[model samples]
Target chain A: MTITILFFWLSLAGTAVFAVSGALQALRNDMDIVGVSFIACVTGVGGGTMRDLLLGATPVAWVNDPTDIIVCVTFAGLTVVANKQIIGRRLDLLLWADAVGMALFAVLGAAKAQQYGAHPLTVILFGAMSATFGGIVRDVICNEIPVLFRKEIYITAALIGGVTLLLLPVGLDDAFKLSIAVVVSFTVRACSIVYGWSLPKYG
Target chain B: MTITILFFWLSLAGTAVFAVSGALQALRNDMDIVGVSFIACVTGVGGGTMRDLLLGATPVAWVNDPTDIIVCVTFAGLTVVANKQIIGRRLDLLLWADAVGMALFAVLGAAKAQQYGAHPLTVILFGAMSATFGGIVRDVICNEIPVLFRKEIYITAALIGGVTLLLLPVGLDDAFKLSIAVVVSFTVRACSIVYGWSLPKYG
Candidate 1:
């Protein structure tokens, strides 16, 4: 189905971006290869796994097939090998990747829930959860405060994307819904990153 | 089946102990009431939920049944309101409760995995994951390195208990298996806590 294809590519992009973000984070924290691989795999599938668990979709996406986890591990390995140039001097690269990954996951996650017949509100919740929880897990494991809890506008972007996907006309194609969701979500996040925009925080 | 009773009691004990541990941890970190309840619920069911997800069981246990989460939330509320002598100065009570929870989760998690037909190795892994991961999530959210990561000998205790449950004679009553597992695991942990035992960490 067109929906499946939409999810397939969006999920793929999300996984790739998430893996890079995690690997770069691990490198920054000076974690060894094992820790890097662990963080990468966790970030890569953590959201989707949580989404499926919430939906009562058994056999969590990666456990039913090790392929995605394996890919994530490989990406981590590659990042480690290219540490000096790609991850070291390019911290901004990791941030952009994280934003893009967050965008894709927000759309894809809500879409999956919709396909499973969840209500629009539930879809929005699942989408935001999928978008942000991975980064939460990653930062938490590294012993840092979660980004969402900090000044970042991460949750807002995911929520916008999820609501946008839900409000689209029913006559629209699934692919069209997914595409628009990404554009809006990614643009919001990308602008935030570039402009150093952040939500107000009490010091 | 007798196994059902074993799980019922162990799960009850697990939920209670996990709730207390979360509440105590929250109080120590100066979290407000909402944060306290959130951490408590997450710690209370985080492990078993992970176990079911890994086993491809859907709807997660608490999502399908709200009773456990409600209990955890209430415990958190009570801990916050009953703050003075019980939870404030007597951190030891919290540690003891955590030990009991670790023991129960270890036994019950492995037993459930076995009942679900997981491999022997997987049963052990899942049991350990179920027992310790809740604490890990708790600590992470509180912005501290997990007790397991630092020097508490937590993983060792959980692994010993899980393997003990797995190796118990099948002909024995499930309740007996559960009891022996608890005794072994709880004893080890209590000793470690009382004696200030810790695993060496490289700085």
Candidate 2:
């Protein structure tokens, strides 16, 4: 019961962060409010929606919980309303927040897949997907190549976090495992941003 | 053997038409050659890839057939080289060609799903998905709201075609059924475009 509560909060935070990122991107592209809202919704919940559909989970996350939509919509609206002020002053902070959200979502995805009896490899893939797919959809909607193809070690960080959770002791509590996973992913991504770490490029 | 060959030709033609649509979209967006090729590949093959992954079809379509990649790349390159001269004043023709491609792909998708022993409804959904997913991805990459959302008749046409194929008598040759399905979908879409037919809008 407690674990479920924690997960709900984590997911909410993740959604908020992703919504902001989407809104930011839309603003950068000079899209209207409707476009901003659309992008935010896609980035905030697109991955989990796909995962649920593919996994045959019923009542989909957002459909079951209207708060998910409200949260995303509110975040998007706020971001758009404050576009200039936010972009000029808090770009770095927003980036860090986005990283944290990615980490949380990645861990949550792995946990959900584990609950559904996915194998280790499948769980890892699901985690990476949950962390990255929203961003991919965002990029595609913004008419840009997916950052996954040519950006920071985004999916790699999620992969590491997922694998770490899988490798953790079986006796550990779910909350503990999830916390460790999120920490690992967040640290990796934050350091990558701070130190200019990136994956090797191949032509 | 003959049936398989026919299906192959239909799929190939569908792929080529889809590639042309993608290439033209990229040209309109003023993308470079590499970007055009990438968009063409995604728009031409993205639907089948999604279907295969969801259905757990091993090796996927293009992965199994190296020639598929060759065909896609060649078409993409050719389009880039000749777009200016060929597409200068033929936007309407391109739309019609895209409708044709959509119809063919939808029928092929229904056939493939039936081959996999899916339920009738599931088969119909797969057919629509296979026909439209590429275009959706293309729109996403081009930073446009997907035509699927705005064009209600598009998916309906695929659905109607799929149902017709499934309901047809089993004794009919596969080619005959396929031809009927394609013509039905094409006619529906063509008429829809010409007459500005659309699904009832909800306020």
Candidate 3:
């Protein structure tokens, strides 16, 4: 179906963005090329892998296909090669790309979880997990507390996007649902990036 | 059927050892009780969770059955409550318990991966994954470099045990094979602790 193809493209794009974001984090931590590649690969597939495992989808998507790994390595390699040129633009680009990846993944993850009959709350959590777990893994590996547990507006955007996906009216086509979710999530993330928005921390 | 019961006990014991080891590591980082519990839970289930996910076992064991979580919490809580009393013997106890965990998980993980028909080499790696991943995750969350990747006898011990599990001759009973693997791994670890052995590190 056309919906499948659209989701395929969205997943690929989201994966690439996540890979690049991970490589950027590696650079920040002064990890070498191998470190960059590993982080990128983990970041790209980590969320989906977790989602699939939690959903009990066997042979995990990436392990069965290997294409996702290939995509991750390619993007990470590109980041390593372009390291010198990306410094000044790195922070800005990283946030934008992370937001894009989060939007796409949040939608896709929620959809997959729903298809698997996850509780609505679980589906929303899956969306957030898919969008942000890679970053958490990356930060943890690099000895930084996970950004997700920090005061960022990070998980909020994913949760909102997931809820939006679930609330699609009965008659809306899948394509319409997907695009609207991506846009709404991306916009929220962008606003957060631009305005330094964050959730309040409890003492 | 007999083998199932044996492995059930092995898995529980391994899970407990991993939990205790994680709580000890959390203590080293000056984490509070909640932090200890969290780290212990992650360490206890992290490897099996990864194994099940990688093997496509749905609902991951812990999620479907809260027993593992309960065990992890109970052990962690005990560690917290007994903090003052156990410190003197912790070093010796930690090493021995960790060895037991690594031994059991390595055997179980390799066997499971083999059951799924993973290549021999991949099975060996899976065993190592089962043994050391929890510690790696534990250290990462604690903002420390993983001990497995350092100049420790840690991963080497797991790798050896995994390979031993794989190379068992065709006729050995499963129980005998499991015991040998665990013993071989524990002995190697014990020697390392007694002799201060470590793998050579590259600059």
Tens digit per residue, CA lDDT, model 3, B121-194: 56766787788778778877777676543334666677678788888896999888888988888787778778
Screening candidate 2 with a backbone cut-off below 3 angstroms (N, C-alpha, C), the clashing residue pairs are none
User: How well does chain B match by TM-score in each candidate?
Assistant: 0.91, 0.92, 0.92
Which digits, one per residue and each the tens of the lDDT, describe model 1 over residues A128-158?
A: 9999878888877877666676455778889
Each prediction's TM-score versus the true structure: 0.62, 0.58, 0.64
**Candidate 1 C-alpha lDDT tens digits along B73-132:** 988888888888575464677778788999899888888877776666556655777887
Q: For each candidate in the order shown, give its overall lDDT on alpha carbons.
A: 0.79, 0.78, 0.81
TM-score of 2: 0.58
Tell me how each candidate scores on DockQ against the true complex.
0.16, 0.06, 0.19
Better of 1 and 3 by lDDT: 3
lDDT of 3 at A46: 82
Collision count of model 3:
0
| Model 3 docking tier (incorrect/acceptable/medium/high) | incorrect
Model 2 RMSD, rounded to 1 decimal: 9.0
